[model samples]
Target: MTPGRVIAGPGGGIPWDLPRDRAHFRAYTSGKWMLVGRKTYEEMEGWFGNRTPLILTRDPSFVAPVPSHRVVGSIFEAIELAKRNGIGELVISGGAEVYETALPYADRLVLTTVETEIESDIHFPECRDPENWTAIHREVWPSDEENDFEIILQILDRKSR
Candidate 1:
């Protein structure tokens, strides 16, 4: 089943774990994506080498470690710049705020319910209405020797579109 979009056009979500969000953008953005957080921005510089990244931040004095990236004033501007690239897909890698901000824009969710419940200071919002979306595809994987939990991958699609 199609989890979202036309199955190819627009954007899709994938559940992944990287110490920094930059790795996610670098690994994914050969397709054009916007890294949506301050830490995600910092992590990209060292991890992505010299690839240009677009960072979204409202703070005016936010100085980036690398000039290959620019801090945009808003998510709208960041997305607009990414759209201008005309690359067919965008990945919204999160740090909570970015995910919440972009959730309304997504038609599909590439989700990974981690094998272990992380004691995170922040958490991803839950989908309360199952009718709004469906898990078209799912997979289970072992977390690792350190973790006894199992991770679940779910691809969810919007019902109406």
Candidate 2:
């Protein structure tokens, strides 16, 4: 996401190409159970590798291309499925709506804040309330040959009530 919280540009695609960020994402998400919206799932097709995808969609007729992928109706259902599969952690990789819907139940948030802002229709939901979350980890990376912009990678954990 950008400094403005923009996740995807007006064209409904990510504006920046950051290989370092991509590698970071893959490092944390590989072999994990990922929950994503239908559009996000389609956009990220063939990128799953060893990870399992739980696609959230209201369409009952929608079927996943991969035999291992699961289509679920809601976030809770996705959680239940992951629990049944003995998954200890579920990663929420999202489009806008999915992020908004899952925000309440999120225990931790892994975020990459790009230094620049771009024109975007999709924005990540606000979850930065100081009372609700604490930044447990953060790393600042400067632009490199592979990455166009500086980025702040952060891990925020939900504060206990």
Among the numbered candidates, top lDDT falls to 2
Query: lDDT scores for all predictions?
Result: 0.57, 0.93
lDDT of 1 at 32: 47
Q: Estimate each model's TM-score.
A: 0.68, 0.96
lDDT tens string, model 1, 34-153? Answer: 555775555444654534556778789998776666677777787687678774555676656677687777777866555433323355555556689978998765655544445555
**How many backbone overlaps does candidate 2 show?**
0
Lowest lDDT 10-mer window, candidate 2?
126-135
Against the correct fold, how does model 1 do in TM-score?
A: 0.68
lDDT of 2 by residue, 15-37 (tens): 89999999999999989999999
Clashing pairs in 2: none
